[model samples]
Target: MSLHPFSQRPRYSQWFTAKPQTVVVQPTTWCNLDCTYCYLPFRRLKHEMSAEVSDALAESVAAFADGAHPIDIVWHGGEPLALGPRKFTALLTPFEELRRVGRVHHYVQTNATLITEAWCELLTRHEFRVGVSIDGPAALNSQRVDLRGRPAFDRIVRGIDRLRVHDIPFSVIAVVGTDGIDHPEELLDFMAGLGCRSVGFNMEEAEGINTDRQQPTPEQAETFWRRTLEWSRCHAGELEVRELEYLGEYLRMIRAGQRVDWDRRRLDPIPTVSWNGDVVLLSPELADTTDVGYGNFLAGSVLDRPLTDILGGAHRLRYVQEFLAGLEGCRAGCEFFDFCRGAQAANRYFENGSLATTETNYCRVTRQALVTALSTVAAKEKEETV
Candidate 1:
């Protein structure tokens, strides 16, 4: 029996048998809308996940997570709602058996363009937490148009309005690109108007199929966040920004004396099953993207074997080994490693050209900038109030 290397230390091991906390299932590789910055490599492949593959996951997860926290299944995609009613229900049916032994929490992250009353009823019936990807207002969403280059802003908003009308609780996720970086107030006001309690801001990350997008400069980001944080403090009780949420968790961990090192052991801590039965660990974004140097990162196929057998086989993969090395290096060298746990591995590979490299435009703009902005605002506010 081999000890899980990531247990109680930050070293690499030849094998690990730990259970993942979440399972990200991509039901299809086909997306209706083609955003300018979409990173899905197989969006045109137009494949969908089968029912048998879904069962393989539910069975394997129930086997290991019987007494653990609620097993989370994040329905991701090219676009999960693209599966529609029949296919979506078909996909979730296998997990029904697992509810007998333990709780299984399901979540769906969608583009909000395909949302309708029927979709809302299905989500309400199952009580699945919903996350809608809408980048603020219509102007900001123009970049996320259909494949034919027609703007999808009106349709996306209409879908969100439908979700609201259905009384279904959901959160919003917006990507902050170069054009949207300086207009944080517009983004903030738009979401606040929608009555969203929490929002996730994903920068136009240089990763996968979208490496050409420019990473925001520190000055541009700092200016945006400082103003945003000030606005957030005014609306503190009404809304919780993503970075502020992370900051709150970090502060709580400090008070409770818990370590803030979100290590590689827990990075994704979830398996992402691609439309075809191929499994990828660490990051869901890495599900279909591959590099020639690392070869195919398909850890294993559920159609051929159970997840338990496939997870153990990750120890032999070169990408996993190199990524672990990068994680170890980030912990040792980077000052922000404690807070971010080396940042996302896919971003490092796309920007720095290797997983073993430390720091990237992503870590700087996303994690480091937020930390600095929040802390700075707190210090300034303290002096004035005192």
Candidate 2:
């Protein structure tokens, strides 16, 4: 008999190797703010995760890490800070243990309203990367107020100052409403003055209970972004302005000779598991049934199904495919598609009805803005050269 049937197979097999990166976890669906364009409207209440659910989530995260994949756990709304220091510690203990064995890295995305000294201590102790949501200054942040209609700018600035005082590393996330569109330079300058090492700009998306469609037009958006990018190129200092919408265009302009190996759609994946054992398909926008594309795409409860199976299931793949197709559609037809990642899932759904079929307002704004700005830059450069 042959030593063994097909026994001499190669030692290395693609199937046996591991794929890095995993899920982004949402610890709760609750939030402190009632921003006009929030995607998680239903998350206004205080919903805490039971120890049982936390334990199950920890196990699931570890399973992914055990497979040679480095797991990343992103703590998000409503406001994870609402969990309080003691409860939050309880929630993170299991993951912290896993981190010692090189299983996971933790990150927190917060509004900075509830950030306290204790919270900062926990974050620094765990070396968690913090991303705080603050629009621009008082004027720009007015729309990001709490349910009581009080502006959160002062509170947010205080939280930021606390972080800086304690030497905790953090980044800022600003939402560009119509007002900010007209004053992009002022907004950019405001954030730059905050001493943030990195800043992310988000265009307002109409979602949740507040259905006000008050975003800048495509032409206006284009102008705003172009101005912001020009400012960045000249006076960014040590700060890195991370404009997700214009990342592709910047990369193309600066690294034209190099092949860009990035997929903006894949920045955050679907089946985002929540604290209440629910799994949402896309961002918080698609989580509420009132939102345009809201459907019961909840794969399985964290307490019920294996995370690996849920992540690999047909439903999850379909959701991602839908988003990828939308992105491709923009890439093929739109002039500024390269700069904006089509549009966000929520924006597409609320504005269009389907994430896959929608033409994003952000896309319109980005393309128009980028092309106009680049043309202006080229003209200026030509004049200088002459």
Off by over 4 Å in 2: 1-22, 66-69, 244-257, 260-268, 290-295, 315-332, 335-343
Candidate 2 on 1-386: residue-level lDDT in tens?
11221331221111112223645566666777877667675577777777777788888777667525567777877888878889888888878888767677788889888888898899988878888898888887887888787787888889899999999878888888776878977887887788887888777766655467678787777677677767877884656876533554566755765434434123444446676766665565555354223335465677888666555442333444555556667768866555555657666656775656646665566455566776777687899999
* Tens digit of per-residue lDDT, candidate 1, span 323-367: 777777887888877777674777877788776688888888888
Candidate 1: C-alpha lDDT: 0.78
TM-score of every prediction relative to native: 0.91, 0.83
Off by over 4 Å in 1: 1-17, 100-102, 260-265, 382-386
| C-alpha RMSD between model 2 and the true structure | 6.9
Lowest-sum lDDT 10-residue window in model 2: 8-17
> Can you list the residue pairs that collide in candidate 2?
29-78, 30-78, 30-79, 31-78, 222-369
Best by lDDT: 1
Model 1 TM-score?
0.91
Clash pairs, candidate 1, are: none
